[model samples]
Each structure stands twice: as structure tokens, then as C-alpha cells.
Target: MRLSATSLEQVPPGIARYSYHRAAQDIGIVHFGLGAFHRAHQAWYTDLCMDSGERGWAISGVSLRSPTVAEQLNPQDGLYTLTERSGGESTTRVIGAVREVLVATEERETIIARLGSPGVSVVSFTVTEKGYARRTGGSLDLAAAEASFYPLLTDGLRLRRERDLPGLTLLSCDNLPANGRELERLFGEWLTERAPDLAAWVAAECAFPSTMVDRIVPATTPSDIDALENLLGVRDEGAIFTERFSQWVIEDRFAGPRPRWERHGAQLVRDVAPYETAKLRMLNGAHSALAYCGLELGHEFVHQAIGDPMLRGLIERLMRQEAATSLAPAAGQDLEAYADALLARFADPALNHRLIQIAMDGSQKVPQRWLETLAYHQRYGEPCPALIEAIVAWLRHVRGDRRPVDDPMAAQLAALWATEGSSGIAAALFGPQGLFSHVWRADEASLARLTRRLG
Candidate 1:
């Protein structure tokens, strides 16, 4: 039988089990994006909190697009296996933090009502980079935005106001820079233009707190599921696999009551900028570099790419020399040590982190991951050789002839590549009207250099 509440007794003794009474805890958080990362990262942290006797913090997960996650978790009674692997060994645990899964399109009213509920104080999101639906400059792209998400959030807030409920904190756990501020600004733009009164109320009452979340969660495979089922003696459809390390740094700003997340290894700091920036430019930037450059060199997984001497050298240089240089010096942040730890993590053989998965949505990702570092170098008249190579690799990868470029701007990128050819594509891509034009439109010298490579 599948791993549902009734099958809890069948689970083995060695595997960590959820002992809490699931029916007693109220749903205090409604998280938007029920992806594997959320299940392995935030949900895991929440599970720890509940185990430590924290009440009223069970999560109600919302899937914005596919019904796949709801289908996986709902039948399992929101009970799933979390396998944390390290050094060729694994530890398994059943996470009972998630109480319900709702497909946004199917249960819009239910989500809104939950958001308005007095018990729910925080509404968090992990909807990936493109899911936020922002244009090049971080303004809300109203037309391109999903009615099920953005407008639905606005309607939810309006309902809260109507019901006289306390303002809820809106938490953004994405990789974007200043994620919390961006969320507030995007919603502010939408609300101000549509309903000015509601905008005013939100500005005064709600909290948009920035957060930095880090964990390496590779997509689980059927083989992995079979292995885990053998260990548990019960199949878990919503099982997730991740590394042993985890970090969550949240800016300590909330509109109302929130979970004591800090009690369970989370950092509640006054500012998350330093931590956020370093992770983006170092870890994420290196990942993108490895993705594009690794794929170009015909490597499949992160462990394989990191083992290659050339790719390893490029990423080390990209982290220590280029990305770390771009960040301002901060107290107690040993960026050199941080770089060392990242390299070690990258080389973990147990992680089957795919290059193509990281390579997806390059048009949406490169701005913070690589382009921002390039921008910083450009400002100081410094050279970023590794970054230049990675950018060239991305320019080549987006042509969409070999592997698929799973991006929202795929058609436009392919059209540019087809129409311009090698002689003109580099200039066209970095030119004023290009996909990355919003972040650092290249000067003539930069264009000429890229053209020479293509030549």
C-alpha cells in the first residue's frame, strides 16, 4: 500500500517517523509552489518545528500550474519520505508538515479563504524565477501575469480586509535579489493601478520579508523511489531526495505572529542582503556556469562536470576570482571559506544534479546569476574571464538546436539565432533590444569580443 496515514504502522523502525498528532496542528502557512525544493527545504524545516512542540504551523501547499504535485501528495495524506544523502549513505524520514495540497486553478476560493483565515499568518512562495512574471526591470507584467496567482493574491488580500483579519506576512523564498522587496513592489504596482484603496491598506499592514534558502535537491527518479520503498516497506509517491546541508536566512520582519523558525536552525537576521548576494553570485552563478559550460563540453550531471579538470578549474575561478570580487566586503563572511565549501558540495558524488535542469530558463536566470557579476566587473574596469566564457557558452546553448531551451523566451532566442547567424547573433543578443538588454547592454568593445569568439 502507498504511504498514507493508515500505513504509518507498517513503516520500518530505523527510518525516522512523524510522531505528532496531525489532526491537532492548524495550517498556519499557505506556501505557493509545491516543487521538490520546497518539500526538501522549507517543509523539512517546518517538520522539525512541529516535532519540537511548535503548534499551528502545518503547511497548506498550493500548486500554481500542474496538478501533478497535488496528485502525488494528496493520496499520500500529505505524508512523504524525505531522504537526506551524504558520503554515499542515506537517512530517511517521514515528513508530516504539509496538511493539504490545493491546485490553484481548481481551488482559488479555498486558497483565498485560507489566506484570510486568522490562524494563517504567513503566505510564502518558491515559484522559481520566471513564475513571478516580472519584466526586465522587476515591474509586474500585468498582461503576462497569471490570473490564478497575482490577481488571486490581490483578491485574497481584499477578502482579508473585508473579514477584518490581521494583515499577513508575504514571504518570498526565491533566488531573485531582494526577493521580499520585489514581491511588495510587484503587488504594490498591481494594487495601486487597479484598486488604490486596497493598495493603501496593504502598504500599511502587510509585511514582505526577504529570505535566502539553500539546499541541493535533485529531481528524484523511479529507481530512487524503488530503493526508498524497499527501505520503508511502503511506497511514497511524493518522496523527495536532497543533500544533508540546509540553510534559511530570513529578514526578521513580520506583520503578525510567525513560526519560531529560528529555533530549528534557521537564521532570523536584521538584513539578509549580504547572505543573499553572496549565494546568488557565488553558488548560483557557479551552477549556471557549470550547466552551460558543462553541457557544451558534453557532461551530464554536476558531479561529472565538477570532476572534469577543465570545468572544475573554470568554476573555482568563477567563484573565487570573479563572483567573490563583485561582492562588497562584509564582517564575518569568509567568502573564501564559503567558496571552498561550495566546491566540496559540488563534488558530492551522491548528488545526481543534472546540468540540463540547471540550464533551463537561462534567459530568466542569467541576470542575477552571471550578468550581475559581469555588470559589477564592468563598473570597476576589471576583467572576468570565467564569466565571459560562461556568457559565450549560454549564448551558444540558447540556440535551441541541440538540447531544448526550456524558457519563456525560447522562440525569440531561436529566431535571433536563425535570423542573424554567427556573424551577427552575438551583437543582436547583447544589443539594446535583446533578452538580457535590461541588465548590462554590452558596449561596442564587448560586442566585438563576443563576435570574435563566434567567428
Candidate 2:
């Protein structure tokens, strides 16, 4: 039997089924990019709130890319299992906070209508870094810009404005430095070009709160689905597996009322900048290093990379030395402790976090993860050979031929590789015309360092 609302009663006792879920509750949130992280993190927190007697904040999840996720869960009545796994132990829970799923390509109008609804006071999203369509110098990529998150967001907010509905809180749960502010700026630029009036309204009424969300959700494999079936004695097509650890830190500012996610262990802080910078530079930066370097050395998974002595050493140096230069920790914040915890999480054997998965879209990731820190290092006269090495590894990964690079700029980069010499290619890549800041292009010493490493 397939797991569904009707089959909830028959679910095995070992599975942690939600008892407080109600289909009749009004949906108060519309989340975009409904992937595993959203399911395991945000939806899990909302489910806990429902269990604790908060009933008005159900989620309507919208998958932007394709209908694959909706196809998997909609038949199950928006029900799915989330298995939290650690070494030799796991716990399963049925998440019901997501009351509906909509495929944006197929249901764009419906999504806009939902976003315009007075009942939905929050429009949260977890679109990855690439979804922002950013250029290298931390500006909006308006040249190749097509239909993306900001465009859709503009249409929805315009609808809300037309309906005279109050502005909603726009929460960004992606892993970008100052994600909320970055999103607000990107959306503002786009809106100003398209509709100046709506842009002003958004500037005044909408609140784009920065957020830091931490969770290790590996891509669910076929074997994982089989394991879920064995554990639950029912088919759960939409099942997801993740590590036991999770954290969410959000800026307290919002345009309107939102779920008291703090009540369920999320931190509501005055400024998420410190937390956001730490995670992006230390955790995400090291993850990219692992991805590019590990792939070059034949390590496929995160644990394998961390377990390898050489890769592990580079990652440690990255967090403790190079990446730390730009970090300003609050009192009682232990950098070493945070690094230790990240190492432990990355080394979890039960989690099959793929290096290639992290490696995807390097063009989008490198700016925030590595280049921004590189800029800080240059400004402060900090040594960053480890970061340079990681950049070399990324360059080699893009240049060499084990698998096709999955970046949006892959074809353009490949064309450059085919045409240009090493110095020329490096110059183009770090040049003003390319995806990097002009300062990098002008810094001959930095260019020489990277060229030496690449050679």
C-alpha cells in the first residue's frame, strides 16, 4: 500500500506519524524550491509547530524546475517520510506540514494567485545559489537573464499590489552571503526595471529576512526508497533521508506575522550576518574545496574525501586559517569547536553526500564560497594558498574530462578553454569581462599565484 492520508492509520507503529496534522487548516505559507532540504528542515519545523497546537501555518510547496517532486508526493496526498539517520540509528517521521504541491511550470498562474492570497503572509524559498542569476562581481546578471525567481516574484507581488493586499515576508533560506539582502537587491533591480511603482512598494512594505539553514540532506537514492519501504511496510515515493543534525537562524524582521519557528528550535536573531558568514565561509567554502579537490583525487562522497588525509588537511586549513581571516565570531563562539563539528558531520558514514553534487554549478558557487573570501584575504594581507589551490582544482575540474561540467556557464567556459592559453583563460576567468571582480583581474600577483598552482 502507498502512504497517503487515508493510509496514515495503517502505518507501522515504529514510524513517527503526525497526529496533529489537519487538512482543513488554512495555508499560510508558499514555499518555492521544494526540495529535500525544505522537506527535512523547514517543513519539519512547521510540522512540529502543528504538533504543538499551532494549526494555521500549513505550507503550499512549489517546485520551480519540474513536476517530478509533485508527481512523487501529490498522489500520496502531500504525505512523505523523512528518515533522520546517524551511525547505526535512524528515526522516521511523516511530514504533513506541506498540505499541497504545485509545479510552477504547469501551475504558474495558480502559484501567483496563492502568493497574492491574503491568507498567505509569508513567501519562503530555498532556491539554490544559481537561482539568483548573479554575475561574478556580486551584481545581477541582467544580460542572460530570463525567467527566474525574481521575475516570478515580481509577478506575484504585482498581483498582491493589485489586490491591495499587505506585503508578505520574503524569506531566503539559500546558502549565500547575506542572502536576504542579496535577494532584496537582485529583486529590487529587476523590479525597478520592470515596474518602478511596485519596486517602491516592495522597498517600503516587503521584508526580505536573511536566514541560515543547516542540514545534510543527501540526494535520495533508489536504495533509500527501498529501505523506506522495508521500514514502513508501505511505498513512500516521496521519502527523503538526512543527517540528524539541523539548524536554522533567521533575522527577526519580517513584513507580517509568521510561524513562531523559534518555538521549534529555530533561532530568531537581530542580525543573521555573523551566523551566515560563518556557515558560508567555513562550511560551504570547505564543501566546495572538498568537491573540486576530491573529484580530482577519485573521491566520490563527502566522507571519503574527509577521511582521506590530504583532502582532510586542506579542508581543515581552509576553515582554521584562510577562511577565518574574514570571520568575526561573537563572544563564546569557538572557531575550533565549529570546525570540529563540521568535520564530524561531513565524516558521517551513514550519509552519502556526493562530491559531484556539491560540485555542480561551480560558476555560481565560487564567488560566494571562495572569491569573496579571497577578496577579504587580499584586503587584509592574509595568506590564502589553500583557497588558491581550491580555485586551481576548480579550474582543472572545469578543464579536464571525467564528466561534463554542470554549470550554466559550462559551455562558455569550455569554449574559452578550447580557444585560449592557460594565462589567457585564467585572465578571462578572473577578468573584468568574466565572472570575477575587476580587482582580481588587475592583481598580477594573485593571477600569477593561481597560474602557478594551475600549472
Candidate 3:
């Protein structure tokens, strides 16, 4: 028999339950991506609000791309387990903050209509770096084909034009720098082109709050399910296993009523710039460097890569040298302490953050984490030996052994590299155009250094 929400008593001990059949009052938030990270971080925060007995802070999960996740989750009655694994011990907590799941692709009109609902005070997204459709220069990428056709074309710009809802806050929990401003510019461009009237309306009303979200949620493995059943004594179809650490920092920008997330561990600040830069540049940038270099070195997972002293040294050097330069305002942040913490997180023997998974979508990632700093160093005449090495490693990853990296931008990088032979790889790296842009095109000496390192 199919499990129902009302069958909580049937659920084994240690597994929490939520009754989907219970009446749900329309709440204040709508989350765009129903990924594992969202389940572990944002949903957990909302659950804390619910536990506090605060009303109107519930969330309606929206999946914009596929129906598979909705199909899997809805049958479980929007119930999911947040499994935390550290060392040899594990804990499980079922999240109930998600009141419902909406498959936006299957119900596009319905999804759009929900945005217009009176109860939805805020619209949030964890759609990763690519979801915003941003350009390399840290602006909204309105030139995308979908920007002309899709309802939100470029991060809800078109939708705001059609509805003109002023009292709405658009929060982005992605890993981009100045994520909120980037969303604004994308929507701004669409408004200037499509509907000037609504564009003006959006300018007057609406909030795009920048955020920094951190957590390590690896793709669920079969062993994880086995462990969950053994520990929780229950079958959980929607369980997400992750590392013990998680953090969220948000700029205080909300319209209408919102949840008191600060009651939980979340930090609410006037400006999220310093926090955002610190996480983006140091943590995420090092992650990218390790992913490319580690994968090329035949490492399968993050922890496995960390096991290699050479790769570990490379990661340390990259963080200490190249990545450190990008975080100007956050310079006071304990670099060594942060690096030590990141190393421990990355080296968690339990979490299997696959190199191939990290290797995917390098095109979307490299621009922010690697190339941006390279450009910064070039413009200001800063030393960047480790950054240059990371770039060389990334180039090797793209070219080496056809290891089947899974990034969406892999094809684009391949095409760019195909213009020249292996020797031309350095030329492309130093090219005047493409994602690297003119600012990052290394001089002959730098190119020679990169070429020598790759060879």
C-alpha cells in the first residue's frame, strides 16, 4: 500500500512525519529550486520558524525544470529527511516546512498564477549560478534565448512586467557575486525592452536581496539509503544526506510579512557584501580549483582528492595566494582558519562529493571563481602564480583524457579549445574574447608559464 501522510504512526521511530492532508494556509514564501541544498538549508530554516509556532512562514516548493522530483516527493506527501553525517555517527530529521510541491513545467500557468497569489510575500530561488542567466561581467544575461520567450525570461523580469506586483521581495540564494543586483539588471533590461510601464512599477517596488548560502549536499548514494534504514529504522524516499555544517547570510530586504529566520541560526545583516565575497572567493573558488585539478589527477571524489598531498598543497596555495587577493574587504577574515575549516569539510571521509559532479558546469562556475580574480590581478598588477596554475589545471581538465566531465558548459569550452591544437589552448586562454575577456588574456610571459605548466 502507498504510504499516506496520515500514517505517521506507521512510520518507524526516529523518522519525523508531516501530514500533507492537513489544511495549509497560504504562506509568505515561494522557493524556485527544490534541490537537495534547498532541502537541507532553507527548508530547515523554515521548519525552525514553524516549530516556533509562527504562522504564515511556510513555503511552497516550485520545480521549474523537471517533474521527476515532484513526482518522487509528492507521493511522500512533501516529506523528506535531513540526514546529517559526521565521523561515524548520523542523525535524521524530517523537514515539514515545505507545504506543497509545484511542478512548474507541468503546471506553468498554475505556477505563474501562484506568484500572483496574495499570500506569497516573497519569491526565493536556489537555482544555482546558471539559473540567473547572468553574463560574465556580473550582470544579467538578457541576450539568452529564453530571455525573449520565458515568462520570467531572465529571473522573473518578464513576470514582474506582466503582473506589476510592487510589494514583493526577490531573494537569490545562489553563489554569484552581487546576485541581487545581477537579477535586477536582467529584469531591468527586459523591462526596458518589453514593457516600460511595468519596468517602472518594478523599480518603485520589489526587493532583490543578495545572499550567501553554504552547505555540502552530495548526491544521494545507495549506501546512504542503507544507512538511513539501519539508523532511522524506516524507508525514506525523500531523504537528503549532507555534511554537518550549513550557513546562510541575507541582506535585510523583504516586502510584506516574512519569517523571523534570525530566530534560527541565520544571520540577518544590513549588507551581505563582505560575507558574500568571503564565501564566494575563498570557499567556492578553491572548490572550483580543486575540482578541475583534482579530476585531472584521476581523483574520484573530493575527500579522495584531499588525500593526495600534492593536490592538497595546490588547494592550500590557491586559497592562500590567488583566492585571497579577490576578497579585499573581507581580508581580515582568518584565511588560515577558514582554509583549515574548508579542508576538514572537504576531507569529510563520509561525504562523497564527486569530482565529476563538481566538474560539471565549469563554464558557469569558472567565470566567477577563477577568471574574475585573474582579471582582477591583471588589471591591478597583482601576483597570481597559484591562480595561473589553477587556470592551467582547468585547461588540462578540459583537454586531458576525455574523462567525461559533466558540466553544461563543457561543450562550449571544448569548441573554444578546438580552434587551436594543444598549443592553441594557451592561445585561447590568452585570447581577446570569450569568457576570459580581454582583461584576463595573459601576456606572452604568462602564457609561456601556463604552457610550460600544462606541458
Best prediction by TM-score: 1
lDDT of 3 by residue, 287-320 (tens): 8777877877888889998889988887887777
TM-score of 3: 0.90
Q: Rank the candidates by lDDT, best first.
A: 1, 2, 3
TM-score: model 1 vs. ground truth? 0.98
The TM-scores of all predictions, comma-separated, are 0.98, 0.96, 0.90
Candidate 1 has an lDDT of: 0.88
For candidate 2, list the clashing residue pairs, or say none. Answer: none
Quote the positional error of residue 344 for candidate 2 in Å. 0.7
Instruction: Tell me the tens digit of each residue's lDDT in model 2 across 68-90.
Output: 98988899989999999999789
Clashing pairs in 3: 360-407, 361-407
Q: Is candidate 1 or candidate 3 better by lDDT?
A: 1
Count of backbone clashes, every candidate in sequence = 0, 0, 2
Clashing pairs in 1: none
Index of the highest-lDDT prediction? 1
Ordered by TM-score, highest first, the candidates read 1, 2, 3
- Which consecutive 10 residues in model 3 have the weakest lDDT in total? 145-154
| lDDT against true structure, model 3 | 0.73
lDDT of 1 by residue, 54-122 (tens): 899999999997999999999999999999998788899999999999998899899988888889988
